[model samples]
Target chain A: MSSVTTTPVPRPATVARPTGRTAPVLRQLLLLALAVVVVAPFAWMVTTSLKDYADVYRPPYLWPQEFHVGNYGRAWDAAPFAGYYVNSLIMTGGILVGHVMLDTLAAYAFARLRFPLRNTLFLVLVATMLVPQFVTVLPAYDLVIRLGWYDSYAALIVPRMADVFGIVVLRAFMASIPAELDDAARLDGAGPWRSLWSVTLPLCRPALATVGMFSFLYAWNDFLWPLLVTSDDTHRTIQLGLSTFSSKYGTYPELLMAGTVTAAVPALVIFLFLQRAFIRGVASTGLK
Target chain B: MLAPTLVVIGVFVVYPIVGTGYLSLTSWDGFSEIKKWVGLGNYTRLFRDPAFLNSLWVTVLYGAGVCVAGVVSGLGIAVLLNGAFRGRGVYRAVFFLPVVTSSIAAATVWRYVFGDTGVLDAVLRFLHLPAPNWLGDPSLALVSLVLLTAWKSLGLNVVLYLTALQTLPADVYEAAAVDGASRWQQLRRITVPLLAPMTFFVVIEGLITSFQSFDLVYALTGGGPLGGTETLGFLTYREAFRLSHFGYGAAVAYTAFALVLGVTLIQWRLGGRERWSS
Candidate 1:
């Protein structure tokens, strides 16, 4: 069950294909054109961020005549961004840690444990995937409010800590792991928890990393729930901070662009580092 | 061991969903002391409400536009990037960058681009083309939102399709070519058929994500320009949080949920069988 090797397809014969040399040149040009389209908005974003207000409104300066490096400082000072950053970091970190620990434990139980009603419960957990988060916003909001967790990190971080998708992915990966590992641990007088901690978790690193990356990205970029839960500036995430920038400084396109760039940097960094896993995660969802 | 998961799911996911269904039938104004049962009243009102109907239409349109555009362009770009090429990795990285960027940030940048005096408008002016106010105009607001969503989501789709393309068995294509199949025929017969599962996956995921489009519209249009861009999700957000109409908002949300669920179920029933066969 652990390994199902797929037969590799034989590579095509190395018959020297005589294509017009211009074909490669043309393909290069076309690919570059595609890349330009893809990168233009981002380039525009960075360029606009460097532009002053006058340069911003002046026919979309392709390059800033006078690059205002101070725009980053101005954008920082434009809102309680420091507080928002700390709040976002803490919330994302808390949610990531909670998800990795809890979801892994749950996945282990679902995949390896022969508990009563396990399949039924796992089915129910998968069914939860069909219900979009929007359906529960009101009740969740009510829960937060009733628990007096509104405008707090508890509201922001706690409910999403146990994600169904994380459990599903982890369970899928865990199901491939041989039960002999757990059995050996049990034979060594290890408890279920000990077997899980010592034997199972170590082997589930790839799945765990995928789950962790996704959880981090989700928590980092989550907007509506945070916006709905936390109204106070002190508890606002970076998204809320950027939105505030938009509303307060609606006229300063350059500053807003700078703030947007600032807000995006962390996610960009994560994507750059864990790109392969991130791409795999995205493709695994079959959302291509 | 499974008890923790069962409890959490039951408490968080199942309970809230059931609670939402119950709330949708109540006259709870979100801050009220007395909760009166209003069986189906919220649903009935939702049908009659012009705002709800319009938002529903907007959501459908947005979903369709994004699905069609994102999937097609994603596949096209993926196919283009499939061949061994110089700097392919960089192009892949650039294409997938939007997936990594925060949606709000992407929307903000797009909002600037779509601004009346922004780069897009300037370009149009340079080309002597008509430049409509994208988010500011009622007619183009939803269209602009759809465009932004497609742009932002295209990267993920590209990566997914690219992965699918690269993983295709080369022998299948070689056999097709041996049978005097042209490139177009090979792509149509072999590639597309083999990619059916990936395509279905893209459609379902695209539908889900497109339906839940909040951040882009929220950041760029705020469902503005006479609520032209107001999706059901946005409407629910406005009603529940902004207007404090919790019961009605819950009903709207449930309505959207039901629609998404119904569509997903249909896709599953239709596509899942085909996937198994393939």
Candidate 2:
């Protein structure tokens, strides 16, 4: 039986040989050169972070003459990084939690629930994605002030909790799940919330992870909103705190580099752990 | 229930948007208790305002430059990295490092690199080339910002495109090779068409992100050298936050929002359907 299947296979055909061996070598060299160009700046950033103040000012040192490990410590001392870390953690966590719960629930409703204006509401939510965040900045600031959330965690956390992008992405994913599962659960006397919690949520882990990671990253790296809403150092997120360091002691390149590395560590850590999910999220949502 | 989510979005997101649209029609100092309806006065003023117009042009140029460079470089890097090579994983990680970093920190580092006595100038001088002060010169400041934006965003696009590239079937390349296709022909005929959806993804994303760019401009240029690098987002920030022209700021914000909305709608109409079908 195996010989019978194999007897009909066609033999391989000969293709034209390479005109020159140097072409592949040249291609490899070009690729490596491109890789170096792409990666050199980041290397420069890390090297500069380790250099002394004088070394930084010196002619474009590709590598540090001496590693100053103390720059990290000094940068920590130069700013309220501990406080910034706390604020950033709380803000990122709050936004992530709110997004996972609120968006998932809304996504569930949009995907499965029978209701009036369901399609209309989903379209409205998706339409909100086009409204650039800048358009709402001023009025949102005023609203925050009126609500007395200025310089408070509430201002930083609450306004961005239920994002339209999050809702749309989650809803799209949730819509792809089979409706029969929800029907089966409903037949078994499960309510909508219970059915979602029991049946739908487990299958939606990848989508949840994607949305959660994005929400966390956005909240972590956000600069303008935090800068506008929080004036006090205590409420400053990591991005704002790093900006403060730059404005206050930008002349101190070593210290600024140190602070920058510190500010960047968390996002890097998250990306390292969830890099695959993050990439998928970017591709699927078309967010860069 | 969905009610709470709807309410939050409505009050925090929807209401503010409506309020901004309303404020665009008025002229009021942020601190003043009075606001006068200005109708098309602000729009007319914006049209006549050379600084605003300069900012608009700079923004368009910056957005276009960054989008083109970012997508092309990102696609190239993604395809290069997608090949079978040792330590490819490590290269992927290294390339993605900048994407994970905070934009403020990235901008700060870039500011130093583009400073008057910085490494970039030193390199140019060493090569016997003219090195204009990048961020300091009005002519170069917006380009400098664009370069920084592309550099900072390169990692995200690479990772995004890499993910899309991995999804392409291996047999497609093998089939192309069997058809007597050279590497360049194979790439142009098979790879480029297959990557169209991802390209569209990157373009739309690049547009939205570039339109709302604020952090790098704020940190690097402060929209300076006579507002040479002032984008719509930064301009809105200045008018609302710095100058306390809250009403005017609100108007600028609405205009930017409208522009972004318009562009995105066109992109969706043109590209999105093909992408979805594919």
| Stretch of 10 with least lDDT, candidate 2 chain A | A14-23
**Model 1: lDDT of residue B248:** 91
lDDT of 2: 0.81
Which lDDT value does model 1 have at B104?
89
lDDT of 1: 0.84
**Residue B251 displacement (Å), model 2:** 2.2
Residue A162, model 1: Cα distance from true site in angstroms:
0.7
- Across all candidates, the chain A TM-score values are 0.90, 0.89
Candidate 1 colliding pairs: none
Task: Compare the candidates by DockQ and give the number of the best one.
Answer: 1
TM-score for each prediction?
A: 0.93, 0.90
lDDT against the true structure, each candidate? 0.84, 0.81
